[model samples]
Target: MGEVGWNEWLSMMSSLAVVLVLLGATLFGLKKMGLSRTKDATKNLNVSEVHNLGPRQKLIVITINNEQVLLGVTPQAINRLGNWPEQEAVDDLNQSIDINQLEPDFESPSDSPGKFQQLMSQVAKRTAERKKH
Candidate 1:
């Protein structure tokens, strides 16, 4: 390429400066509008639970100001399920599920059991056997 003259160099630098200014202004506008991801988006609400009903349906439980609400979500729309009532704390032992109590093939387990669930089941079985003896 031919040598860049002083005028060409100055023009190139001015163009770069204009681009930087526009980028900075866009960032500033997003921050002012509270649309920047750097700020905590869930400061006022907490997602307590989520259940997948089907490919396009989901159940989401959200907590805000110590109140919990259940929401049904689908591709088309969102609907309120109901308000979940807060319960008194219970012991962990009472919350434990017995593997033997689980129904055999309630649905096809091979469908969507992810790696984490598989590992957790293995761990739970080992722990339960250890507790038995």
Candidate 2:
């Protein structure tokens, strides 16, 4: 194969430079138009927590526009499980009794079932109550 000449090298470099300039300009234009992801655009929406239920299922808590929303996510669908106002969520967090305290006691096998049932019932009750308001 023939060696590349100086002119060929120069032509290749110039073409590369032109392509880089175009790419940069496009990115800059997109940012100016607010088409690119920016803090301001996402300030009102945030994922607060995520819990994996199974290999293909998860529970996600997100805060949007001052409301907290619980979502059930599966491979095929996303469902809204519950919603609460931000103030209520804050009050719950500030309470002396933590929700984790109500979780099943892993150390005592016999206590686990009853505690788990209590926790599930409380969650169901809370969801139902929130739906009414």
Top model by lDDT, which number? Answer: 2
Q: Return the lDDT, model 2, position 113.
A: 38
Model 2 TM-score on a 0 to 1 scale:
0.48
Clash pairs (backbone) in predicted model 2: none
- Stretches of candidate 1 off by over 4 Å are 1-42, 86-133
- Candidate 1, residue 90: the lDDT equals 23
**Against the true structure, what is each candidate's TM-score?**
0.40, 0.48
- For residues 16-83, what per-residue lDDT tens digits would candidate 1 score against the true structure? 99999999999999988989667785586878777665575556768776666666665555766455
lDDT of 2 by residue, 1-133 (tens): 9999999999999999999999999999998887865447458888987766446555677999999987766555576767889888776534323345445444542343344344445555665655465
TM-score of 1: 0.40
